[model samples]
Target: MQTKPTKSIYWGVVRLLGNNFLMAATDEGLCYLQFHDANPAAGVDEGAWSELAKWARAQLPEPNWVEDAEKLQPYILQLEEYLKGLRTTFTLPLDLRGTTFQQSVWRVLHEIPHGETFSYSQVAQELDKSSAVRAVGTAIGANPVLIVVPCHRVVGKDGSLTGYRGGLRNKEKLLLLERAGM
Candidate 1:
């Protein structure tokens, strides 16, 4: 699929709830936030920018990247507040890029309230594509915005945690965090 070229892309690293995340932004809005680990040899890892650049290269043409941690401060702050249970909804602009179907699934995912869970089939039914439960699962798996899109709110029909790109541990923690209102 063809994608528009963006003029600027910024990268930042922030810690929340004991985990480090790489935040990427553009003039349009926040694009990606990926999990990172600290480097034992040094301090916080700076490798996230390289990873972000690689992801951008595959998604866009000749992305102009800069390490502007400050540019993503607003998003980081909001996320911190969210982790602290001080916020239930995100107000940051999302530059989510995905197929039309994926976009629809992500949009519908937002309807799932915090501390609540919906089965994949339920999400499919909500989208009026009850037969596309697997497709809904795939879309949720492909969600680019992670916590911002709230894909973790999806569960198995039996209410069991299924899959999360960021891992089940993180997913479980997020659920518990929300459930405890912490």
Candidate 2:
């Protein structure tokens, strides 16, 4: 009982304050996710956001579409727990939307695992480069899923905190949470 048949694109503009969020959902799973700061482009758009709501409906346990305002609850819990130092890993199906090269870089980020950090040069080596350290940095910068993708785990070759879209302050918070055994 589907409609005219276009790919579903669900979205949500989360008021994360210092960590504004944009969550997107698709028919098969949650896709097209990202986060930004308090910029005007970061909030939810009623019409544009409907796609994500529809997509999220498709991913719900119920087969048919229904207004399930609570689908985002679990994700909120996960994030809250993360910030409180009560959680480290996220239990969500992610949709990493990027070009092939970006996806490759993201794959490297995923392998960083939880509570561990790596260097951009190290990631370049893992990708068989040993020299594309700068390129690796750019890819990481373009990452859509922040904490979930674990880009914060990637640092400078000399073990110093590097740049983060959420800012070095938030990055420090994430790293500190992990180092504290959260």
Q: Please give the distance, in angstroms, between residue 28's alpha carbon in candidate 1 and its true position after superposition.
A: 1.2
Inter-residue clash pairs, candidate 1: none
Off by over 4 Å in 1: 1-6, 39-51
Q: Give the per-residue lDDT digits (tens) of candidate 1, residues 58-129.
A: 666687778787888889989999889899899999888888999999989999998888999999999999
Per-candidate clashes come to 0, 5
Q: Positional deviation of 78 in candidate 2, in angstroms?
A: 2.2
Candidate 2 Cα outliers beyond 4 Å, as residue runs: 1-4, 15-19, 32-36, 39-69
lDDT of each: 0.83, 0.69
Which tens-of-lDDT digit does each residue in 1-182 have in candidate 2?
A: 87554544444556553566666554554554455444535456554345445534444433333223266556666776776767767777776666677788898887886778999988999899887888889989877667878899998889999899767987887788788883
Cα lDDT of candidate 2 equals 0.69
Distance from true location, Cα of 129 in model 2, Å: 1.6
Give every collision pair in model 2.
9-51, 9-52, 10-51, 10-52, 11-52
RMSD of each: 3.5, 6.2
TM-scores for all candidates: the values are 0.88, 0.71
Q: Give candidate 2's error at residue 98 in angstroms.
A: 1.8
